[model samples]
Target: MITLTLQTIGGLMIAYAALRVHHRVYTEKSIDKKVVNEMRAEQIVGIAGALLLILGYLAAF
Candidate 1:
């Protein structure tokens, strides 16, 4: 379970970084709402994953 959690966190972090670069800051006004929503969702997932990882690591002491 811990290994799975760590792997999920790593994947989420990579995906989040990609979304942040490609969708978060746009110079065009014609961006799709779906893209915006996905970006936000990805960010949340990434943050949650990171927090879970930290908490799990702390718990393993």
Candidate 2:
């Protein structure tokens, strides 16, 4: 139970950080678009990780 909670919290933090970085990129047009794309990809990964974390927690019971 504690492990699941930790994983969920960690995933949320990762997703939030990704959002912050993603937004920061918008303020700088000189940055590469590929970098922005990578940020978007990481956001997707964070979402998927959160889903897996939830499923694992449920399965553990």
Candidate 3:
């Protein structure tokens, strides 16, 4: 039970962090090389977070 709870929390935190990164990019007014790179990185991180969340749920069940 503790492991399940911890995994869920960890997934949520990672997902949230990815969302924050995405939001930061959205709020920026201009696009540049650095921003484009950050966007690509954020997408990777977001996908990773989603995968983690899915795996955590599967493991918990």
Better of 1 and 3 by TM-score: 1
- In candidate 2, what residue range of length 10 has the lowest lDDT sum? 22-31
TM-score of each: 0.54, 0.57, 0.53
Per-residue lDDT over 9-47 for candidate 2, one digit per residue giving the tens place of the 0 to 100 score: 787777677667766775566778887677668767766
Query: Model 3, range 1-61, lDDT digits (tens) per residue?
Result: 7777786778788787877777777667478878777786787778787877778687776
| Model 1: how far residue 55 lies from native, Å | 0.4
lDDT for each candidate structure: 0.66, 0.73, 0.76
Q: Lowest summed lDDT over 10 consecutive residues: which window, candidate 1? A: 22-31
**Model 2 misplaced stretches (Cα beyond 4 Å):** 1-30
lDDT of each residue in 1-61, candidate 1, tens digit only: 6786677568767766765675545434367878767666776776777677667666766
Whole-model lDDT, candidate 3?
A: 0.76
Write out the backbone clash pairs for model 1: none
Candidate 1 segments exceeding 4 Å error: 1-23, 26-30
Residue 11 lDDT, candidate 3, scale 0-100 = 75
